[model samples]
Target: MSDTELRNDGRLEDEHQLDADDRLRPEFVDAVLDAVENGDTEEAHRLVEPLHPADIADLFELTPDERRAPLAAAVADLLDGDVFAEMNDYVREQLIDALDARQVADIASELDTDDAVAIIEDMDAEDQREVLRAMEPDDRAAIEEALSYPEESAGRLMQRELIAVPEHWTIGDTIDYLRGHEELTTDFWEVFVVDPAHKPVGTCALSWILRTPRSISMADVMQREQTLIPVDMDQEEVALRFQKYALISAAVVDGSGRLVGMITVDDVVHIIQEEAGEDALLLSGAGEGDINEPVVDSYKARVRWLIANLFTALLASFIISMFETTIERMVALATLMPIVAGVGGNAGTQTLAVTVRALATNQLTQSNTARAIGREIRVALLNGVTVAVVIGVGVSIVFGNPMLGGVIAAAMMTNILVAGLAGVLVPVTLDRFNADPAVASSVFVTMTTDSIGFLAFLGLATASGLVG
Candidate 1:
């Protein structure tokens, strides 16, 4: 095969491909680090030269903090727009901080409008202004317009470079225009056909344009049924629209319904990944939860949750204090009390995770809330009964007190049922009140399970005259 064909198929023999695990091997990373540390900049460049932009980003991430600058200097020429776009956010921020504002502007100018906004958005206001000043006027205007939108909105995510043709043009005219205009965006799946006022009326897939007769008018050949994303819509909502409508690309319109930009599937993929990770971190009260997150930031994010847990735990302790006399009288009650609380807490967490995820994905809506609740209640019943029987039988044999076992069993069932109810209700209630269910649900759920578990078990023992 010819060299061009070989490169296209990724079958070039000289290309350094990723390993089976798709990670840079330890030895390779070590050698490059050693080269940078030893002041062999040329050698370090040679080692990283064969890697792709993404792999080069990985190399920077893998290097020690002290070595990252030196390694970056070694591979400075290769750290282009693609490499910066592919770098981890924390790593990219570290590199951006190391560069001058003019240098940063140069890098931003090389990237697409959306990517340029992403890089600039994280800088402080003074640094942002400096960088924007250094950029070309047209690039600065596009970035400024994007930055005006709320963070995470479609306006921030959509690309400014898109093909929009007047609906009055025929296929032949459209084809000629596209062929002649070398300044048009190089990557677009569809052409948006707009009216005189720039309102998007229909969309024509590139494939459709290629197959249709050139004599046909753009208005007649274009598909009027199109998914239009609002400029102010959240990126998550934008992703959902793309998913629901099976859209490869959609026109983004302003409040007046004028076509402003386009959102393609590639942008949605990143939003989906970020949203998924954000929810998972929020559920655990671990802000960002990224390994690359700063130590001070991680501590600040986690300490407040830990403090909240401490207070809730004290509340559970107070309930146990009320039953201190009962626990002391029967050591068996003390031994088995933890089991009740532990099992109930596990059950509650399982339910909380499911409910939080469902709510985040819009799966648990008002129409299905009742059904979702009923389903969890039944699950709790089965789980409670099975656990109660196992613990009851074990206690009877070990403590030689079937009545005591029966008392503990009853407590287990009661606490588990309460846990199930608390788990679902806490998140749903928070969501209803405009709170993030994932961030606060676990705190409330754990408190409910612990306090109720202790109260039910001790209260049952006291009432049955099994203890005290």
Candidate 2:
């Protein structure tokens, strides 16, 4: 095969090969880099021509910002709506800034509502308004309405463009309308049947339209029962509904049950990814945690949590300070104190991780809250005994003081049990008060484990007269 005839997939070059998921192969990426270095724009375009828009987006993401301009210019027209839609937010914003408002609006018009909103939302308010003004009046209005909703809500996430027909329309009429209409959404799985007031009354799958007789009324063929999402609903809740129902797509309705938009599986797929990532980041006290974030912004986001942690650490120190007399009197207490606190802290962190995940996924609710707490308590007891026996015997042999060993063992058992309880209870309590469990729970758990560990070890030492 000629070099052009050798498809990236190792297939003989053909138009059909063009439709394949031709990712930017390592060689192609290398070729682009080499061409850019050599200032061979034609060679760069030739190398990029075979890749899909998503692949192009990936290239942009992988390339450094310095190389992006040359690479983007080399394949100028190829950066169409699909490629723009798939680009990372940071990259897309940068690229959009390079283009004028009209150019950005032109590209935005080709994308679906959710994708369009995503592209423009990151732009400055003035740029956003300019782009909106450049759009068709109807499209501009729909986007403006979406922009008005709180960010990350269902309204902002849904696509305003969708296929809907009056319930009274016959199957033939619906089919004809679909085939003839230029304004309908390019991709849809179900055609919503709406009432005179624009409320969604039913949904008819594409298969039903193709199979049913032309004369059948949509009302007769449409499934009357349908899942409708409220515009103001949380995106996470929308994802849960999609998961629960195994939905391909669902209608989005306003407060009065009027059909306003539609959310497809494509949108939900992004939501699931975003929500999962957000939860993981929040658990780590990282805010949004985007790599594109400025260093100062990142430091500012994390410092607040670190500051809160410093205070909690001080509280733990105060508990240890109260027992300074005990530590000074018995130097061995210093050697053994960390063992109690470290193990308890680790155990508490494990429980806290599980609890936060459960709460985020809605697996832990009021009905089973008590049962979960009881289960943790029992597990803690079992774990405490197992660990205490091993550590106690080891300490007894090493310190040559059975009393000291017994004291450490008792403290370990007490602290670990408290750890388990605190881990489960702290997050739940925070959630109950409408606070994010992931954000605030770690600080509380740290405080609990440290304070308890110190108190248990020191009090045991003082009461047993081990210090005296």
Candidate 3:
């Protein structure tokens, strides 16, 4: 964060490499790349040395694609496992592809099993094997076990590195054992107390262990109640558990109930952020929505959703065709249709967003489904009536036709009711069938609002004889 004049030119003048927010300065990034491009390796190193690992990762992401390899080469000594861990997935993949198997293995060996798996899991299969071969037997074995589990499961997300000791050990003995070990876990908040079978009996926080007399037994100090995560539990569910319990760390266990690994709060924070962002993108029908995603990949992801929306729109179009004659009679009906559909669509989206979030967070469940639906319906009724009165009065004055105004008002109220119902029902039904509601709910909700909106307005007009 401090200033260093690593270069003479005004563009390269480093008042500070990072701003107050800790992000790498735009000019700072330019200076590093400027140094690298000009073959000033020492200058590049001097400019980049002040950054944290996360900021170093950001520098790579900010660098141009062609310059990334060169920038990486210039900062080769700085590109450790921590930098790679903080990096964006696609950006890391781009850089990983440039490294040889041994070089990749060296970096992976320095990280915990979970971090190593993140780097190696996306690699090409043959190249992955080569990296594994280059790694030490212990690191390779740990990573191989992690990769065998389903991606994004607790098994894949938990780190093999953790502290576990027998419950019978005295606090003094535990302290001695910890000090005696040269290869114990470097960072942990709690020491897991396990039974003779290595099944966790309780967790002893560092504070408890440090505060208590060392001569006291660990069993006397450990808290028996502890949250245990299933190895195969999905990471999203894992994050929920962590958030619900306010856990700093939890032991991950196998089906047989043996402690396998640990998930810390730091890792859960990333999963929580990732799952939240992913849900938002899915609701919008955008896949992944990563900025570093290739053009073809983004196109493939977005076009399918657009195509699905296109087909749903055709359904709405067909409904409109049924009332062509009625629309032609009033002319004004055409102008008002979009307003009904657009407002109803917005209302449905509002309901859908709330319902999906509730479902994801376990706030909405089978026991409360009826209550949630009823609550939304009541809100929708209020919304519908408020909207109906405004549009009804405006239409009556503007066109000087109370009958026409009445028809549009009735149509608006009916459509809004249908939209609210569809919004809640569509996602809940999808959830009931074990489908992901966020990914598929929007299409159906929009379709229902548009089709029902058009049908209600035109049908009410024809039925009311307003057009005749």
Candidate 4:
């Protein structure tokens, strides 16, 4: 007989695995839902049982909202901690809302501290309290203490589950202790060594411990240099520290310098993704931008930006109004003016994106800001000259007016140069003032490029008597 297990549906276990797309196939999802709809909970369980926890989570997400609770009921046994951890925030919240406090507590209990806190943190205040009350005392305390920390802080992100030992213990003692401790966390790459006062002094990777002589003291074998993350540090900064040090996991220290928890690279990965996506959405003034976000919430987040855009656009319109007579004299002026402003706006946006990313990644800093600005200016000058030549020749041929061409060429170059400067300067200035550059940079940069482009082009046209 083949070693691989065959399912009741006549498919091998290997065939039941998730595909590369990280999504369940349509037919498979339909089959599961059909089973649930027909009230065949056992068949629904059988179909979903072979999928990975993450795939199961995706299945819940794929299921429609009203049907989600029914599906959850059908596959209640599969709705464990791993599935909950991998489920989307919106979907998990929906499911959690339907469960009783005890059920939620049971699910939270099965997860690591970080994942458990993630589940509980989204609950309504009273629901959170009730769920906390339903949890085992120890689990409740851990969740409550995590809750005490500010959201998005390291304290809230770190897991209380870790392996820690005294520095004075020998390799033999450490090995014996590890083998004997039934309650110790199963997942860890390194063992932290703490002083008598419970302050982390060093760390010893599992390989090092296993390779070392049994008589070697933990103090002697452990690497003394360690990155200790402050519990109160922001998650972004925490991710930076992990990235900078290439850490697998770092010890989380409290105000008293005691080792309280550990932040693993796995958790850092999530934070990195969240922060990167957040800055990107903020740049476009799109709040969260998660499809799971409520309609009203999405509207509230986007409408303000549209309103702000209306006002900024009016500012550009006002600039055009100032040159109304010049435009009316030469219709060509109106046709060509948009080219200068449009190209300049695109150039500005490109620079703004780069500057914002550099700032976020710490690639751009005070010491390098001047050199960075100079570099951008040089690039802008080259870009400006190139675009100016193309637009200049095109307009000269199209309008059959060499003077008008010269006016636009000069205007394009001037506007692009200003756009580049405004792009870098706007974000840098916002960062300097402790404001989030990504949140407001585009609006200001667009305003600068548009206003300057119109002013430069029309002013030159009027001055040269081409428009008159």
Model 1, range 307-338, lDDT digits (tens) per residue?
Answer: 99999999999999998888888888888889
Looking at model 3, residue 284 earns an lDDT score of 96
In order, how many clashes per candidate? 0, 0, 0, 0
TM-score of each: 0.94, 0.90, 0.96, 0.95
Candidate 1 accuracy as TM-score: 0.94
Q: Identify the runs in model 2 with alpha carbons over 4 angstroms from their true place.
A: 1-30
Cα lDDT of model 3 by residue, 62-172, tens digit:
887889999888889999999999999999999999999999999999898999999999998999999999999999999999999999999999999999999999999
Least accurate stretch of 10 residues (summed lDDT) in model 2?
1-10
In angstroms, the error of model 4 at 324 is 1.5
lDDT of all the models against the reference?
0.88, 0.87, 0.91, 0.91
In model 4, what are the clashing residue pairs, if there are any? none
Better of 2 and 3 by TM-score: 3
Task: For residue 129, give model 3's deviation from the true position in Å.
Answer: 0.9
TM-score for candidate 3, residues paired by index: 0.96
Instruction: Supply candidate 2's per-residue lDDT for 358.
Output: 86
Encode model 2's per-residue lDDT on 198-256: one tens digit a residue: 99999999999999999999999999988889999989889989998999999999999
RMSD of each: 4.0, 3.5, 2.0, 2.9
TM-score of 2: 0.90
Scored against the true structure, residue 200 in model 2 reaches a CA lDDT of 95
Residue 418 displacement (Å), model 2: 2.2
lDDT for predicted candidate 2 compared with the true structure: 0.87
Positional deviation of residue 425's Cα in model 3 after best superposition, in angstroms: 1.0
